[model samples]
Each structure stands twice: as structure tokens, then as C-alpha cells.
Target chain A: MNSTAQDEITAYVFAVRAALGDLPEAQRDELLEDLTEHLTEVMADGEGPLTDRVGSPEAYAAELRGTAPFVGGFPDPPTRPNPLIELRDQVLPVLRTADVKVGGVLGYERASDFGRLLRPAWWVLRGYLAAMVVAEILDGGDQPIGLLPRIGGSDGVALILLAAGILGSIWLGRRSFRLSTWPKAVLYGTSFVLVIVALTGFTQADGYTRDSYYSNVTSYDNPYSQVEDVFVYDAQGRLVTGARLLDQNGQPIHLGNAYCYDDEGTYADAPEGVYPYCASKAPFRMPDASDAPLPSPAPSGISPSAAEPSDAPATPSPSVSPSPSK
Target chain B: MDTTQLLKGVLDLAVLAALRDEDGYGYDILRRLRTAGLGDVGDASVYGTLRRLYNGGLLTTYVVPSDEGPHRKYYSLNPAGRAELQRSGKVWQGFASTMDDLLRERGTA
Candidate 1:
């Protein structure tokens, strides 16, 4: 018989056998021993299908059983079903229903039919994902991912690997169904793991895109990392606290950290353009400052004079002379 | 009345009679019976009758393998099958005549 004819005959026989399931095993086998051959003959001379010629398999099985109850050395009827057979009997209906229902939702006769159509697309995708794993391994996973993996930082290798991977994957996909049970199981396991690896690789690739898109805002090689606060000084060389620095176009000059703690340990925010983020932490000292401004030539003689006129002209001369010369 | 219900009673005899003239496969026998005007005789009924008669030692089967595809199983009536067919055929004839006479008087065509 042709393959289609063979398949139909096989299905017909299988249904007949299943319909005869209540009979003992040996009895059922005896009844169906010549079924395939018989079906082949019946289909050959029929103008229509085997079902149209013979009727439904169930009705056929009933007619077969109607004859000779004691002919085949019948054994006692089956006491209980084999566990595996029981499981199959219970599960087949639900699975068949799901196959039809899911298939209907997908606009196919069966879900497996839809799955068969997607196999080639999956083969290509699986090949690409497999190549990514290889590239990641070859590159030691250090390089940032691009549109395609550059194994060992070479575009040529990436293209070759991609072609080989996709072709090889398609080749394997075509033959996978024909594999023996054990090897097929192994392939299924590896396919699942490859899916997980692909998900992780895509997530990392997404993060890389975000980093490059916002590179100016946050960069690992920032030049001003050590600058905690900015302290502006005028040409007179006196510290200008609360000095807001702006660019030539009058845009605020934002640099350095803008937050600090005062001497009293109170938190403060002196956003950029307002230089000297913390006045108390300024690099330069003013007249009568807490650090005494500088080493006084006479600690006792001038210190009291400078302190008495805290805002007076005497502190300015002392503060100015020392700053310009030093 | 359903001819299928009637065919079930005489199917074994019909199968034996079909095999008497020439040995035939399952489908060949079905074709012969249909050609002989037992159009309502089913495929399974013939095949099933063949199996039961074979088991009862009244028919024999042999396989004829073809070069192209699946083989054919040919059934032929043995001596016991021929004898049973003749016996059943006579009984059917007697029943039909008796029914015919009873119906001819009681009913109009």
C-alpha cells in the first residue's frame, strides 16, 4: 500500500483492536491477526473508503465478536487493566480534545499541525541562539553584545559561526523526530536549556542598550569622581561661598557632588552653579576664620585685633596680603 | 425490515458459498457476494464469518504475497464448509417458500 493507504489501514486496525479491548489479549489478537491484510484487500476493490465499505470500526468489531464465542481458546476476561494501559485510556480523550480545541483556536485542524508549520522557523531561531552561546564562550563573555555576536572580536568569525549554526540546527531539527527514544529525550532537555540561555542573553543585551543610550549621564570612566564639592575663588584669592558658577551662555555649571554635611552634622544640598557645596568645608579661609586664617606673626598681638573687628577693614588687609603673595 | 439483520443470519453460509466456486480474498469475496445481489452484506460480516468458519474447521486460508505492497489472504471452503452451506441453503429455501405461501394468501402485491 502507499503510505497514506498504509496509515489509513493502520488506523482502521488500531480502532478495531481498541474496540475489541474487553476481550482477552489472546482472543483479541486472534480476531485481528489478519486485519491488516484483510483491510488492504478490502480497500483495493472498494470504490470509496474503507469506512464506507465496511462500516465503522466499532460496528465491525461488534460483528466480528458476534461469531464464535469459544473458538480462539478464550482466556478468562481481563481482571484489571494494566496501569500503563489504564493511564492511556484515561488520558487519550483529554489530549485529543485539547488537540482539537487548541488547534481550532490556532486556526488549524490540530495544534500539532500548527507546531509542524513552526518547526522551520524554530530551527532558524534555535540555530541563532545556539550560535550566541558559542560566541559568548569564545569571547569569554566579556565583550558587549552587538546585533550579532562577534566571536573573538571578529565579524568574519561571527558570520561563519552564524551560518554554520543555522544550517546545522536545521539539519538536526529535520532528523530529530526520527531519533531513538533516549537521544530524543536528551535533545529535548538541551533545547529547554538553550531557551533559558537565550532569555538571559537577550536580557543582558537589553541592559547594554540602555547603558549606551544614557552614556553621558552615567559613565564608568567619569573624570571628576574624586571632586566631592566645588569651591570657587575670586581673582582676589578669597573663597567665595554661595557663589553660583555659570557657563558663558549662562547655563548652570553642574559638577562635583552637590550634597554635604555641615559642622553641626546637618545635611545640606548645594546644587551645582552654587559653588562651595559646604561653606564650612571650603578649601580657603576668610579673615577671623575658625582656623585663624593663617599663622599670625604675633599670635597674641594681632589675633585679638583681627577678632575684635570681625567685619572691619583691619582683617581685609591681613587676609589679602597673605593670599596674593602666597 | 433491515436486510443487515437478515444478512447476519445467513452470512456464514453465503461466505462458504462464495468460496465454493473459486478461492478469494476478503474484498474479492465481498465483491462476489455483492455481484450475486446480496448488496447489503457488510465487509466485516463476511470477514468475520470467514474467521469463525476457519476456526470451526470448515474453511481454510492461505496467504499470497504480492511484489508491490501488502499480501492477500485467500479463503476457500473445505468439504465440511461445502456440506454446511448445502445444509443451510436447503433450510433457507424451505423457510422462504413457507413464508411466500403464507404471504400470497394474506396480502396483495
Candidate 2:
């Protein structure tokens, strides 16, 4: 028998078997016997060739089983429901759009399965670009040159660092954006670290300037006579109060017997002006001069006035002053 | 109608009528239909109608094993099938008479 015919016969047998499942065993056997006998007799009685008259095994089986044969030509058999259809419908649209955008990044004219494989690199490239944007926004003002003794001028170093950071970010971004997969992740991560470093460097430079101003103010014991709280310590590290006063050059100006008092009410008498008074309470606000050239400190042990003036202002003359009467 | 077309509609009824007296297989049914001047009836049409009627609960079928060739399926009408045949036969008779009346009247007119 032709394969198709055989298949049809098998299908007919299966269908009959299915329908007969509800029948009692004896009835089922009888039905099968009857159909077989009938088919055999029909085939024998055919005047022409049995195949031509009775049809193929499949057609014969279909007719015997009461099924309609192929009317015009065989149509594809009805298919079972596909479970993936729902998921495919939902996911395909988003995937297609993403493929378009990512394909452009990868320099592809059309998206294909091969192009989709580059998605990991595309994400990394996006990350790198984001980092570069952040870094651009964060670049800040120059550092104070007065803070670092070895690095010399802060302006040059700040400008150089800023330029290097900008160039590095651009380089990393370009490199990452060119890639198609996770290798771009490395570039993105590096860009992120570079941006963080640049921000930290700017912050540290600002902090150094503030700390330098504080140090300058603290160097003077007392520029004004207004009393301030003083933390005085004895030789043994014992806390003492009422420390003496001094100038910005650290010179003691007063002489008297003054008693130092602890919060516990004990008073220890010392030479009145021996202890240095704290200057923190006297708010010595520095001039707002971010643009002014910083005044370099005088040589190690030299007094401010005695230092040779490289760019200091001229001193005022006293020859025109009036004499005071006794 | 041509004998072929006429036979198509009544083929099921004719097969049932033939099996009314005794059970027969495919070849026996074909032989009887031929003898009855229904030679124009295709062999497939008869066999197909037999199977259809059997499936439709009008005819009961049984296999008789043969020593020489394949086992033969024999068909017989049960009570329900016979009653159905009688009812359909009556309806057909009525319709045929009506058609005959109309055709004769037309002819005379």
C-alpha cells in the first residue's frame, strides 16, 4: 500500500478504536469483524482493478469509517494549539525595537540573530556614556596652591588633572561604545571610577584651602584683647584654664599673676600672662579672595615684617606725624 | 435524472432494501444491485453507503472469516434500521408522487 493510504487506514482504525472505547468487548469485536468482512467483499466485487474502483486503502478506510475523503486535494491536517504563541506575541515587539537601537550602535544596517548577540556590549557602551556625562557635570574649581609644599602651584596641577580626566572619559566612552558585548562593561566601569576620582580630587583640593585658612588663624594667640576660652595644660597634661595672651607671631604681651581654674573649682596660680589664650572664639573671618595670589609663608623662623618683600606692599612713613605732649 | 445521479441519492436506501432479506458482503451487495438494473451505481458508492448506514446506526455489520481470502464484512438491518427505512421509503414515495403529479399537469397544460 502507498504510505499515505496506509496512514489513512491507520487513522481510521484509531478513530474506530476511540469510538469503540465505550462499547462492551464483545460488541467492539463484532463491529470490527463486520467492517473487515464488508471491505473485503467490496474489493472482490469491483469489475475493474480493486485499487481503482474501491480507492486507495486510505480512501476505502475513510469511507468504511464514515469519514469524508480529500475533496479537491489533501489539506494539511489540523494542528494542535501552540503554547508559545502568547509569549512570542508579547516579547517580539520589545525585542525588535531594542534590536533597532542596538544595531545602530553596533553599526549594523539591519538586525539579525547575529546582531542580537551583541546586546551585552551595547549595554556596556550605554553605561560608559552615562558615566562620561556625570563626569562632565562634576568638573570643578582649581585647588589652593598654599596647601601643598612639594607640588608647587595648585592651578597647573588642577588644570592638568581636569584635562586628563576629560580626555580619558572620552577615550573610554568611544572604545566601549564601539564594542558589541560585555567587554564594554569594563570600559564603563573604568569611566565610572575615573569620574569618582575627579570628583574626590576636586573635593580634597577645596578642603585643603579651608584647612589652610584655619591653620593661619590658629597661629596667632590673640590679635584682639577680647577674652576667649582657653584650654591650658600643665606640664603633666592636667587641664588648666585662663591661659595668657599672645600675638599672631606667638609673643606673650602681658605680665601678672592670674589663677587658672578647673571646672571642679580648683584654682592654680601661675604668672598671670604665661598661658596662651585660644583664638577660636574670636571669629577672625578671612577676606573673600579666591582669585588673589596666596601669600606665601615667611621663611621658617623669620618674623613677618622682617622677611624680604618680593611682592609685599610699601611701608608707610612716620616723618609727617605730630609729636605727643607729656 | 440520469441513472447515475438518481442512484446517488437512493443508493443508501437501495442497499438497505437489498439487505432486508439476508445478510451479504460487499461483492454480494454489488451483484444484487447490478442485477436490479442499478449497474450505473459505482462500487465505491455502494460500499461507502453501506459503511455510512452502519455507522449511522441503521445497519449492523459483522465479519465472517474466509479460508481463501480476507475476512468479509456482512451487513444486516436491525429493527431500528428497518423502521427507519420504512419511514424514509414512505416519505420518498410521497415526494415522488407529488413530483409525478406536477410533471403530468405541466405536460397536459
Candidate 3:
């Protein structure tokens, strides 16, 4: 027979087999034992298309069933009651009803149609989740999972695996319909586990993001969280060392710690209530003794510029806090 | 009258009777039945009936290699099948005569 005729016979046989799907596999196969040879004969005898000659394949299978439907050659063995079959009998009708009802709500003819349309999308996602699962297994749970799968801290390995996984998944998903009993069962079980993994990964990611956002809000709420020390300065911006800070009601207010970076760069305690406790950590440079002579005899305790009138602005330090009044 | 509905009742009998004189392949048997004036007999029905008879131990099959295309599977009736044919043929004749008599009495023959 020609290739077209051959194709026609194959398609006809497939349809007939599908129509007979309700029958046991062995019976169906037995019934179609000579289907291809018979179809080829029919094609050779006729001139038009196979369907035009023999009616539709489905009708053909039905007519075949009408004459002498299959009788199993062997007496049915005493079979143990299968719980899965019972579960299927219970669930299929409910699922079919839900398919229709859900389809109506979603404005489709059937929910299964919507699901069919989303199958390719699911294939892609299934691939990503599979990659994640593989990554976890390879790492032996020693590494924390991120949104993307990384194997041995290499993005390249992860990328290659991800690509392979997605492609392989799509291939399997497309062909999964053709799988036999046990392989299909394995496929379904794997998909179920992958779905759980995807959900868990998403939940962890959400929590991590929420916690970081909360920390940002809490730290911004209080502006003085890291205010360690305060230095007073005049309108002239001169370093006002040893100046006392008083509150609104004549009460001395303490702000900075008494310990500071000393002259030798060591942390040491200074006397309490002394504003500019460390001279080596002054915020501004002062005039030399030759440039500005002190009128009063207090050069050792305070700089000559500190005794001078407030005439200039002081410099700013990123680490040191300016007086709140300033 | 649609002979297909009528053929449905006796296709098993027809298929068995076709293989009574000579063993034939599915397509050949179908052609024989068509030539015998059961023109509406479906190919699938004949094939399925042959399988059922074979499964029921009334028919036996063997494959013949052919150069034209695929190998042909030819079916032949066993002694049990021949006996069944005789029995069903008599029952059909009796039923037909009774129906004919009733029709004649009703003036619709």
C-alpha cells in the first residue's frame, strides 16, 4: 500500500482502539489483531477515502461490537478488591461535575479545556521545580535554598541543569499521555511532589521579604538609634570643648558616653560632665599658640579659640553627632 | 428497510456460513457476504464476529505471508462452528416462516 493508505490505516486502527478503550487491554488488542491488515484490504478494494468507504472508524468499532462483543478467553481470576478502583469510581463523577461547574464560573465550556490550555505553562513550571528538587538532593540539604537552584555555588551548573530540566519536562509532559500504567503513575507522583516543593519555596521567599521590610520600618521609626555622642559648637563653628549642656529647666542633660578615642587612639574613660573629653578627637582645627595668644591663663584646660567669641562655623563629622540645639 | 439493522441479528450466522465451504481472510469473507447479497454487512462487524467465534472455539485462524502488503489472517470454522451454523440456520428458518405466515394472515405479506 501507498504511504497515504498506510497512514489512513494506522489512523483508523487508532480510532477504533480508542473507541474500544472501555474494554480490557487484552480483549481490545485481541479484537484489533488483524485490524491493520483488514483496513489495508478495504483501502485496496475501494477508490475514495477510507472513512467514505467504511464509514467512520468509531462507527466501525461500534458495529463490530454489535455483532459479537468480546468474551474473555480465560475465566476472570478471583481478583482481590482494589481500593484504587473503588476510589476512582467514587471520584471520577465528582471531578466531572466540578469540571463543568468550574468551567461555567471561569466562562469556559469545560474546566478541563482551561486546564489543557495551561498544560504547557505547567510543564515549564514543573521543570523549574524539578531543578530545585535536584539541587536540594545534590546538596544533601546542607545549603539553604534560594528562589533559583544553585549547585555547588555555580550559576552555570544551575543554568545548564535548569535548561535541561525544563526541556526534559516539556518533552515528558507532552508525551505523558502515551505512557502505560506504572510509568504514568510515577509521573503523577513526581508532579505532586514537585508542586509541594514549589509552594514551600514560595512561602519561604515571602517570609524573608516581609521580615526585611519590617526591619526597615522599625529602624526608620526611631531617628536617634545610633546617636552615640554629642559635641557642642558655637555660631562660629568652633569646637566648644569642656562646655556644659543644660536642658530646658536648668537640668544637666547627659548624651554621649564618657569613653572616647584618646590621644594615643585607645578607648579610655574621661571625667563625667566634661563635654570635649578628648582633645585628639576634636572636630575642628584651632590656631597655634604662636598665631593666637591667650589673654587668660587657661591654655592647658581649653584652646585659645574656645575662649574667643563665637565668630565662625565648625566642620562636620559623619560619625559624630552635632548638638541638637545647633 | 434498512438491511443493516436486520444484518446485525444474523451477521454471526452469516460470517460462519461464509467460512463453511472455504476458509477466508477478513476482507475476503466480507466480500463473500456482500456478494451473497448481504450488501450492508459492515467490514468491522464481520471481523469482530470472526474474532468472537474464534475466541468461542468455533473458529481457528492462521496467518499467510503475502507480497502485496501485510500478511493475511484467514479464519476457518471448526466442527463446533459448523454445528452452530446448522442450528442457527434452522432456528432462523423457523422464525422466518412463522413471521411470513403471520404477515400473510394479516394480508401484509
Candidate 4:
């Protein structure tokens, strides 16, 4: 027989067998064998189609059972439903109905399956944009970037923009917007690039560094506890002055020298006869004034005046004052 | 009346009777019964009756290989089947007489 005919016959026989599920194996097999033979004969006769002559396979099986009463009565067929089928039956109606309702509103009632599948893609993109908006807001001072204008400083504008993007994406996903081709390309491409840039900025943010916003805030420690030794030395290593020191931020105590807390700290320019009380808490001396001309002191460590002219006398400066003028 | 139901009751007898003179396969027996005026007889009914008779040790079966088509399983009445046909025939005669009497009375009424 041609395979198609054979398959048709097999399907018919299987349906008959399924209907006769309550029969004993031996009896069912015997009946099926006879039916097969009979069907073959009927097919050869060509009086009519098998189904036309015998009715449905179920009815035929039932008639077969009606003839053989000696075979024990058929039991009720068992009911075993597939779980995936159960889930699909329960879930598909709600999803399909939603699709239909939304599709109607969007005038996409006849949209292809490809368009329907695109909803999840839009949702994912919207989710990514939403995260970026949140991160931009949490970062506080960093400006939102992209083709869109800055919506102002706070995350509030970013938040509103994010909500708009999400809603717009959802509408587009549902085909309600049905944006033009170029517009969609521009919007998605811009958003994609913007999300990448925002991610990079978020990873590199270091706004919480020490000098930021907290630069001049004093420690809560007691002024007395904060005081330390404040001493000044001349280029020849002679002691210029001594007093109680203040903290680096100048909180606790203030010595006579205004140059102490200068931006250069220990490197401040010493007046002709006076020593510069360094802002740095570490003890240090001035740089050598004996050099061709005195150089401004560096921000850190003893000035070269103290280190270079160590072998010289304790003259404060030959041009400015006499030797015992300490 | 649904003679098909009535045929069901006598289908074994009819099928066995069809094979009495000469052994025939399932379709051949079906043709013989239809030719005998049991036109309402179901194909499955005749085929089932044949299988039942064979299983009841009343009929013997053999396969006749056909080069023209599929092999045919031919059913013939064994000695036991012949005895069954004789007994069943006598019983059917008595039942037919009773039914005839009842029908005649109904017709007159």
C-alpha cells in the first residue's frame, strides 16, 4: 500500500483501539486483526469508503463489543491528561484574549506573530532604560546624557523621562504608536548608546572621595586634645619660634604666623626676620636662604634652607638682620 | 424494527450457514449474506461473528495467500460448527413459528 493509505489505515485502527480501551488485550488484539482484514476486503470491494459504511471508529468498536458478550464487559476508560496541555488550556485563553483586546485597541488585530513576539523585546529594552534612569538619579550630581535635553539637575526629571520612555516603549510594543522606520531606528539606537554610556559612567563614579563636599568640616575632637607642638626653625637650623600647634584645618589653636596655614604649608615664604610656622603637622625647618636667592618652600617636608645650610651659622639672614637677632 | 439488531442475534447462525456449503473469507461471507437479503448486516458484525465462531471451536481458519492482494483468512465450519448449526437451526424454526403465530394474531386484531 502507498504510505499515505497505510498511515490512514493505521490511524483508523488506532482510533478504534483507543475507543476499545476497556477491552482485554487478547480480545482487543483479535478483534483488531479481524477488523483489519475486513477493512482490507472492504477497501478492495470499493462499495464506499470504510468510514461511510462503518460509521466512526468509536461506533464501529462499540458495535464489535455489542456482538461479543462472552468477552468480559469493558471497563470505563481511564482519563490521563497531559500536564503541558492542562497548562496551555488554562493560560492560553487569558493570554490570547489579552492579545486580542490590546490588539484591537492598537488596530493590530491582524498583526503577525512576529509583531506579537516583539513585545518582550521592547519590555527588556524598557527595563534597561529604567535601570539607567534610576542609577543616574542615585548618583545625584552626574548629568543625564543623550540627544534629549537635560531635564534639570535632580533625578526627578530623569525619573519622569524614564517613565515616559517606559510607557512609550510599551505603547510601541503593542503597536499603538506604530512609529515610522527611521524614527524607531533613531530612538532605539540612541537609547542603546545612551544605556552603554550611562553604565560606563556609573562604574567610574567616585563622587564620595575625601575632598568632596567635606573639605573644611572640623573633627569633633577637643581643641586641647588637638593641640600639638608648633616650632619654627631658620635656614641655619636656629630655632626661630615655638608655640602650641593647631590642627591642619586650623581648628584648636592659632599661632602668630599667618603664613603657617598658607597653601604651600611648610613651603610658605618666610618674612625677612621671621620664620614661617608650617601648616603641616609634621615638624620641619625652612629652606636655605644662602642659595643665590631664596626659593619658595615646597608643600611638604623641611624647606631646603634648613637642610642645605646646616653647616652655616644661625644668622636669620645677612641682609635682613644682625647675627644674635634671634 | 431494526432488523440489524435482530441480525445481531442470528448473525452467528447466518455466518456459519454461509460457510456451510463452501469455505469463504470474511468479505466473501459478507457478500454472501448481503446476497441472501440480509442487506442491513454490518461488515463488522459478520467479521466479529466469524472471529467468535472460530474462537468458540466451531470454525476452522486458514490463510490463502493471494498474489493479487493481501492474503485472505478463510473460515470453514468444523464438525463442532456443523453440530451447532443443526441445533441452532431447529431452535430458530420453533422460535420462527411462535413469532409467526403472534404476528398473525396481531394482523387480525
Which one wins on DockQ? Answer: 3
| Interface RMSD (Å), every candidate | 4.9, 8.3, 4.6, 4.6
DockQ of each: 0.23, 0.09, 0.27, 0.21
Q: Say which prediction, candidate 1 or candidate 3, comes out ahead on TM-score.
A: 1
**Candidate 3 lDDT (Cα, 0 to 1):** 0.77
CAPRI class assigned to model 3: acceptable
Estimate, for each residue in B1-109, the C-alpha lDDT of model 1 and write its tens digit.
8998777667776787788889998888888999999998777777777777787898888888877557778888888878877877777788789989988889843
Alpha-carbon shift of residue A91 in model 4 (angstroms): 70
Task: Name the DockQ score for candidate 4.
Answer: 0.21
TM-score of chain A for candidate 3?
A: 0.46
Give the alpha-carbon lDDT of every model. Answer: 0.74, 0.54, 0.77, 0.65
CAPRI tier for the interface of model 2 = incorrect
List runs of model 4 lying over 4 Å from the truth: A71-326
The collision pairs in model 1 are none
Comparison by TM-score, 1 against 4, better one: 1
Per-residue lDDT, model 2, residue B88, is: 65
Worst 10 residues of 2 chain A by lDDT: A317-326
Query: Where does candidate 4 clash, by residue pair?
Result: A267-A297, A286-A306, A287-A303, A287-A304, A287-A305, A288-A304, A288-A305
Over A1-326, each residue of candidate 4 has an lDDT whose tens digit, in order, gives 45555566677788999999988898899878867666777777765556887678888778878777652112214668889999999998888888777777767873445476776776656655655655545654455443232344544665666666667666655663578888878867876776786566555554445445575444443332233223444554444553333435644443233444544544454442233344343343345434423333533443435446554323232122211212
Error of 3 at A300 (Å): 99
Q: lDDT order of candidates, best first?
A: 3, 1, 4, 2
**Top candidate (lDDT):** 3
Share of reference contacts found in each model: 0.54, 0.22, 0.66, 0.50
Query: In Å, what is the interface RMSD of model 4?
Result: 4.6
Give the CA lDDT, 0 to 100, for residue A96 in model 2. Answer: 88
